[model samples]
Target: MTRIPHEMSGEPNPLRALTLDRLRSRTSMKWRAYPEDVLPLWVAEMDVPLAEPIVRSLTDALELGDTGYPAGTGYAEALAGFAEKRWGWEVAVERTAIVPDVMLGVVEMLKLVTGPGDPVVVNSPVYPPFYMFVEHMDREVVEAPLGADLRIDFDALDETFRRATTGGRRAAFLLCSPHNPTGTVHTADELAAVAALADRHGVRVVADEIHAPVTAGGVDFVPYLRLPGAENGLSLMSASKAWNLAGLKAALAIAGPAAAADLDRMPEEVSHGPSHLGIIAHSAALRYGTDWLDALLAGLDDNRRLLVDLLAEHLPVITHRPGEATYLAWLDCRALGLGDDPADVFLRRGRVALSSGIPFGTGGAGHVRLNLATSPELLTEGVRRMAAALD
Candidate 1:
């Protein structure tokens, strides 16, 4: 692996803010000719390509591709190994199954674990998919919006759980670790609190750790299953985001003995044949993708510092609480009068695309989720456009 030299400049790292020179391809924002057409800072995907080792592994797999039915099996072991190696969580390979994606795992769990008319609770201003999954499943979507700082509202959660119990509502909690939009990584204390609530209500819990790998330092993310009552619950994970393999549909559904039996009872052919390519890509990522993860983390750490410091200086009106995880930056654009449609204004007027806060629920109303996974140049350009738009 080749190491790139970086300078801190006593002032601030340019890599910390955003830069465009780290172009991954001709079509991405980095090298695209008419980048002014759209500076995409909305999607969770990074403009950077997959790490070199991951790339090499997939390239080798394609070379051996016969287009024949892939052995796409052995995925559970791969996930189990990765989990044990990364977080010291002892997940048994037998207790795992492959879902096409993390959100799919949520959908499938809804199908099997939740009943129609059952209430599903989620922290508001969360990943929109959690909202969609419940609504699409015909289950009730219950919102437990975060507190003033946008961290989980423990009191509200307790009250909601009690009311659900009193009102004959069996509710399931979908907890997002290294939470989306806000980027508050739920700590073990938070997880334990939620676990106690779920245990009291007999409501199952599913912890979504899809953005597990990219959490900035100084933040701690507890594996949902590692919580006290988590053994009876479930933990959702994936290598796609960390490995830049989102296009490759492969994720893991991990549970303890009881939950494992439930998953085993699922159709024998749940993950039989998949995008042969996805399987090949997923396998390699789990097996040979760690080193690249280290380098990516370094780059992301720099980008995060840049966003935080720049927000403090030039865009004072736009306050940033800083993220604990993921490449997403949650910005407080409310003070700038950037308009109720701040994200839209940024996209249409400033030529920078970003995730709208409204869809993330009430707490995120005047906020915006900006993608910081792109090059430092692109991030800087987007931030520059944002500063100009606000002033």
Candidate 2:
């Protein structure tokens, strides 16, 4: 496969630059999970090629035989620099720990704050893993379902937090910043309110910010720790989602000032999970992949608009509100007369696989999450297939 060069003026949109023949040749789950007839847009993986800097960094490591256990603050430092520059948020390097990936980091963070059988709060119509991981750890998941607008519902959150902490029992809230499926980016005010509520109820907060770098232009992505009263919060961040490095597993678990000691309690063996090559690739992406990320975001923005137009032209009954971040679109398809899981129908009838809404919990019923990170041709075909499923 010919490598697409870094984003440049006159360059085709990265999302549109790749061809179906080239994409189908790949072996990733997105390609292999379905037969050639099925357009697989169900997973969060982006179809873009790796950024030049990441490729160069990994290549140099392999050629030099530098593959070994990771042993430095380089990844953390790179993420700190990226955070400071991108969001004007300062990250105290000493307060961060390298984890295997965002989900594992979240699991470790939850372990620090809650015991088995303790309640973990999540905003539903959320990433399904939030339920799976927490339950796997023997913890209970409590839902504070997102409001009708797909944004956080403060009243529901407050009540849920109150219930989770009844009788002075400890609890944790797993926050999905720039949320998945729905792609609702929580505002600063909303986060501040969350901090106040968590503080009031004695519930610890852990945020998954894997999609931080994928926000559309003009949207401010706020770090949870940046809010006052949130000094006890923890956040799991990674470049995997934005840079298409899911195969490379490395992430940072950032601690708020007050939670530094809690993070210090994480077992040493947990740090051994990340691959050295993963660290190298993630560090390169954070340190030097800004231009490529910006270009990808531009392509994603175009794809978002393209999806809106396509859906309107074909699947007119489906309602989509474009999110400010992430490439996933949360679509409401109840009016189409499809049952609870529309994705099943689309896949069986039209051979276009989408994320089933039922697995996402609560408001996920009668909805489907569409990934918008592919070329215009593929996205259009996916939409067309979805529409044909109705016939």
Q: Model 2 residue 291 lDDT? A: 78
| Candidate 2 lDDT by residue in tens digits, 118-234 | 999999989999999999999999999999988999999999999999999999999999899888889999999999999999999999999998887677788899999999999
Off by over 4 Å in 1: 1-36, 66-73
Clashes of each: 12, 0
Q: What is the TM-score of each candidate against the true structure?
A: 0.89, 0.97
In candidate 2, stretches whose alpha carbon ends up further than 4 angstroms from where it belongs are 1-12
Tens-digit per-residue lDDT, 1-391, candidate 1: 1222223212222223333444424453333533646677787777655655567766777787734444634666776666676666767777777776888887776666778878888888888888787898898888888998778888999887777657666678887887888888888888888888888877778778888876675454568887676777877788887777777777777875557766776565656534566766777777776655666666788788888776776687787877888888988888877666688778667787788898887677778899888767677878888776654
Model number with the top lDDT: 2
RMSD in Å for all candidates? 4.5, 3.6
Candidate 1 TM-score, C-alpha based: 0.89
